[model samples]
Target chain A: MNLSGETKLFLGVIIGTIAIIVLAAVIMSKPTPPAPAYTRNQLIPIGANTKGNASASAFLVEFSDFQCPSCKAFSSVVESLTEKYKDKLFFAYRHFPLDQHPFSRTAAAAAEAAGKQGKFFEAGTYFFANQTNFSDEFFAKAASVLALDATLYEKDRNSNDTKKKIDDDRFFSDTARLPGTPTFFLNGKQLILYDSSELVKAVDEAVK
Target chain B: MKEKFLNDQMTNRILFILSLLGVAIALYVTQSFLRKTPIVCLNSGCELVRKNPASYIAGIPVPAFGLIGYTLLVLLTFLRTTSTKLHKTLLPWIAGITGGGVLFVSWFTYTEAFVIGGFCTWCVISAGNMITMFSLSLYSHSHKK
Candidate 1:
């Protein structure tokens, strides 16, 4: 019953190749799932941090945390898209500070405070650009750089209004069942962010 | 004496084949992750399960780790089949690796079923391969010496 070593190696290769081919065929035969139906709802709120035309047909909402590295990475992309589609897209940012980041809430409040002075997008950009610096001094410096009223910025940063705005956004995110930071919603439908190109494609589809 | 030799060769052949299959599965999954392509699936749940943040560890995709594991197993199997001295030396390590792989498969299966509430067809197949490989490796080891 002894077999030559060459025979064993050849048999092993054959068996392995057949197994691989079968596996590939099985995977290829799988049916692709239909596109998921996203529920349309009113995700916008009054005084939300927004850019672009309010009446644009394509509405893009971002649920992001300032202290989240991924969120910071996505900020520039979001900004570029907003500018590119300024005439046809409306972009909004909502706070979703994760509990794991100790400075996330403070950053969210800082952005909201800047929003009070009609500089939400600018403040947000600053927070994302300097994510490693999250101290109060840094926030104040951002306000100064933006030429916001120093005294008003400090007061508004700690105001009940700023806290409420952030809290409300968190509540909405929870209700929508968002899994993580940097989640995007297009026209009230969630867009899975596997890649930035996916976001662009979704936006193009929405625009069409 | 010839029957025993033939059986051992057959066992090694089976192990090599299974290890190859494992590498193929790992490679396919890793490719999907790297390309950011949706995993092909007969079930609607593959997307849901794969999109979860838990699908990755410390920014590296879980399948990438799987690919490494399978590659190591393939190397070990190849060495075992080619050299008697290395075969004896690597047999225990192979057994431990396959055993760990089975346990990991079990944990991930439970996580996908209960925690994620979705399943990837590829993942399930890979887990099946791991279980078979574990069982066969144990059987071969037990019958050795």
Candidate 2:
């Protein structure tokens, strides 16, 4: 078939436009690793400090960082799940303070210190709620709001025990090869399903 | 003259079939995204790959782009098959468009394999369709007199 120069130029423009669009799409999308599957057999012992039913058959373990925006966003979902499941679920929160967040370790330390006073969950809730305003003063204010002993809280925050607790959780996170913060494991199995409804269904199945 | 006609007919038929296949795969993904339902996946990574922020461009699903591309290919193929003048005019352009789709699909496939660490079965099917269509279009354009 004979082709005109004008047609060739038009085709070239269409092809170039498509190429640019595809390239832009690819560039805009960030790559993320697939969530890993963890088995119940590999479940580590839940630490002394945790929230929800201690005797529940199903456990939801969250490896979270206070400064992570996704973790903050998921906090309310976790709270709703805890309320809905109540006695049926054991919720364990572990500290996995990422180094990228300048104040994450301090926040983790504050939460751990609050745990020493049986107010870890409360402190965690406060931190996640006020993630943008995290500071030494904020941690102090949270401790006071929880009615924790200010002196004891300060001492505990700087204690080796608190540091070890955070380190231990980090160790478990590393061993599990967690891809990022806000990762959840239900009864030791990673929740790879992204949808909340699907996750709820999975939880219901596990309960059975 | 007869041989050339036969070749054109075969090329058009292949392009039509492949375009249909591409459209089906893209439609499925688009629907899954819109409906907020789990996509049928032989591989476990489909959910992860789909949920990734990378799967969308400015909140628009990537598969929507695939749907548009495949739909265009179908229209182009139909035009090329029905009108001799249009066929000559559109054949090279079809090859170019298919080539671009192939490149895009290749990048998506690479992300699924290397970055996402999980493959979506439907996505793989769509990529396969794009590759086959690109090959057929390139061959037809080159063989054209």
Candidate 3:
């Protein structure tokens, strides 16, 4: 079974053509979206955060990292809503650091340090509010703003307890299927946070 | 010797196409695996391999490696059309490389299934591609007779 050089070249061309076509088709296919946000949510609570005010009737759990810009934006919206709907809504913040973000876990740890100073919510609020100013110097500056003891802030920031708290939060975030930051679970149901309006509508719905 | 060489050349062409088919299926499965991100469950353990840091090397997915490897194998088949002594030596080395790749991926699949506790559809497809390449190489090696 001998084939001429021309025949071999022809076969190669045909194979190449088929390969190119199949590869092109595969690459061109539209990608599927992530899990639908409107789906059910059996909200899993994180460490020491017992669904925050269980009696509040409406619960909103946020999967966020202090260094995340989107989380910062959503934090403001949540704050406004929480103030307006005070005592009617319960808000809980959980850490979910993007793997590539270098300073996210550090910011999370710093927040925990401030929490030890009885300023968990305050530290969380300020951390997201001042995310643009994150650094060693800025962390200390924020601590000063929060009136936390500098000595304890430094010691607690490096403490295993702080790390464990972040890790535990991570576990809950992971279980909740929180892909990236700023994911919200309202009333044990997943809410679409694509836009503030949608979020607000979802939140208002929960309260009703 | 001429007849023997021509026979080997044609056999390589067939083997090349077989490996290419394997590569194509592997690519399909790779895409399938990535589609189910944020893998919610470990029932199948596919998510473990999908999320594994080693799943991609230098940012290129593993299936991409197989795609390129098979394409090169296809090109090498065309090169063998004329019995050049240089290509005769190169073919076995190529075969060995393909075989070694199969072995490496097999171990990866094993680790994913047993150690990581997850089974990735794409990883399985890539493993299947390697097995086909290895088998085709064996067939080609025999065709040298």
* Candidate topping TM-score: 1
- What candidate 2 gets wrong by more than 4 Å, as runs, is A1-48, B1-145
The DockQ-derived docking category for candidate 1 is incorrect
DockQ, prediction 1: 0.07
Q: Order candidates by TM-score, high to low.
A: 1, 2, 3
Model 1 lDDT per residue over A1-208, tens place: 5655845775577577768768886886587564343433356778788889988878998999988766765677798889989999998888888776788999998888888889889888888888877887787687789889989989999999889989998998788667676788898777766756578788888877
lDDT of 1 at A169: 89
List residue ranges in candidate 3 displaced over 4 A.
Answer: A1-53, B1-145
lDDT of 2 by residue, A65-138 (tens): 88866576567778888888888887778777877678888999998888888888788788888887977788
lDDT by residue for model 1 (B10-62), tens: 77667777878787777777766765555656543455455656677797777
TM-score of chain B of each: 0.90, 0.92, 0.64
Count of backbone clashes for each model? 0, 1, 3
Candidate 3 lDDT over A1-208, as tens digits, reads: 7877755674776567687967877765757454544322345444443324556878787778777655665677787887776668877777788665677888888888887787877888888777667887887676789998989998999899889878877886777566556677787666644345667888888788
Candidate number achieving the greatest DockQ relative to the actual structure: 1
Shares of reference contacts reproduced by the candidates, in order, are 0.06, 0.03, 0.06
* Candidate 3 per-residue lDDT over residues B1-145, each given as its tens digit: 3344335556566666666675665555455445533333222234335444556667665666666776676666655655566447657866886787788788777777565445665566657766766766676666664
Sorted by lDDT (best first), the order is 1, 2, 3
**Alpha-carbon error at A96 in model 1, in Å?**
0.8
Q: Weakest 10 consecutive residues, lDDT, candidate 1 chain B?
A: B1-10
Per-prediction interface RMSD? 9.9, 10.9, 11.8
